[model samples]
Target: MTPRRRRMVLVALIVLGVGSAAAFALTAFQDNLLYFYSPSDVTAGKAPTDRVFRVGGMVPEGSFSRASGSLEAHFILTDYAHEVKVSYTGVLPDLFREGQGVIARGRMGADGVFVAEEVLAKHDENYMPPEVAKTLKKQHEKPTNSGPLPTT
Candidate 1:
């Protein structure tokens, strides 16, 4: 092949390779990225239904109703403006209970309930996970059914 023709082919191949790399990166993220939005954000129309995402909020007091020997339980996750009902049918975390901060990883069901595949509760008093502490502080600033949070 002529020198000029060979160089032109090499340049074209490099460009194609770069473009393919970028496209693959984007496609991988689109397929695997899992967003976690807060309950306030979800109520404010920030959560998308098409993709699986998470919702974090405070579990309202008296909102938890557990079935005997069954994992199915009903609860409410709320922000100040609105509340979302959740129905989870799995083992909850040890700290999971009423009047505590929780982050549920799942999608909103067609029936308007947040179907949680995983439920995370607030950690202990002094040794809370950084993420949970930050979220709890944000939720405590607002008032809803979950009232009178413990003071540090």
Candidate 2:
């Protein structure tokens, strides 16, 4: 082949290689991406069923329970408007407790439960994960009273 033709073919091959690599990297990134959702979002069917994602909310009082002889625990996560049941079969974080903000990472199970691979709790009494705080804020901002305010 002529030198010019050989050079053109090489350039085309290099471009193809780079394009293929980019596409592969993008696919990997997308597959590994984890999204955050509130319990309300999960209850509304907005969470992905086939991919790992995060659910954050308050663990309601009396909603947490541990198995008799196992590390497995079940709890309900709620954003005041909705709730999602979560199951985690491992030691929970030191700060994990009912009536506190928590976030769990996992995928939804066949039984509509969140099978958590990792569970995180708030760092302190005054601290809450940003996602959880945002969800709670949205929940509390909804007007509960439709009637106009009355003055004394």
Candidate 3:
């Protein structure tokens, strides 16, 4: 083949290789991609139990239970109307607290508890995790807490 033809073929091969790599990467990531779902969604059966995913909600008051070790913790995620128990064996975020927002990644157990592989809290701004935002948005319409306390 001529030099020009050879160079054209080489360029076509490089492009095809790059595209194939990108496609493979995207497919692999899809399986690994974790999506955020609210407690309400989980209860509604919208969350996939088999796939690794994230659930975000407010820690229900009176639901946090400390285990013997600093590694294990049990808590509940609530969207006002629904709740799911969560168990995690790892260091929790500093800002993680009851009534605050949290995002836990893991799978649901047959016993109905969420087995969290990791837990994350909001880092900056007024942004809560997407799942928490969804829950709070739903709860906003229902009859709930009146408002913040009236400071003297």
Candidate 4:
């Protein structure tokens, strides 16, 4: 009922409103965030199973395949130490090819295949995605070789 009490109440309400708005914005941003992972990470079971994420690697030689009369395609992505199978039912980018870097956004299926929603290919031979480069560097830096990478 007092003027001072009314101002205090108004300030409290404003603070509460701002806090709620900030919380909402952060939540939305987190939901849209796509994390990049390497084939090694995926093989180690570190990739998210219920949400979309990104996998970056090279399209190994002879790993890319397409069905006749269909847009469906399959490819094996490799980081040299590990590999992942990816399936995409869409037109690939012009830069897409074997032995090239690529980043695929998708979720892993129960059958251990990556169901890609979108595929991004490297622009040039010298260019590689930062995440992919980092992953490859780490793989090479390891002192011991885990196993031979799968052949296409």
Q: Relative to the unseen true structure, what is the C-alpha lDDT of residue 139 in candidate 3, on a scale of 0 to 100?
A: 81
Give the Å error, residue 12, model 3: 10
Instruction: Score every model by TM-score.
Output: 0.79, 0.92, 0.72, 0.92
Structural RMSD, model 3: 6.1
Compared with the true structure, the alpha-carbon lDDT of candidate 3 equals 0.86
Show where candidate 4 strays beyond 4 Å: 145-152
Supply the TM-score for candidate 2. 0.92
**Could you tell me which residue pairs clash in candidate 1?**
none
Segments of candidate 2 deviating more than 4 angstroms: 149-152
RMSD of each: 5.7, 1.6, 6.1, 4.9
> Which residue pairs come into collision in candidate 4?
none
What is the descending TM-score order? 4, 2, 1, 3
- Candidate 2, number of clashes: 0
**TM-score, predicted candidate 4 vs. hidden true structure:** 0.92
Q: Estimate, for each residue in 1-152, the C-alpha lDDT of model 3 and write its tens digit.
A: 99999999999999999999999999998987878888888988998878778888888778899867578899998877788899998888888888788889999998878999999988765878765786688788777577887899
Residues 47-82 of candidate 1: C-alpha lDDT, one tens digit per residue: 887767877776778889987899898898875446
- lDDT score, candidate 4, position 145: 52
Task: Write candidate 2's Cα lDDT for 54-85 as tens digits.
Answer: 99999999999996989999999999999999
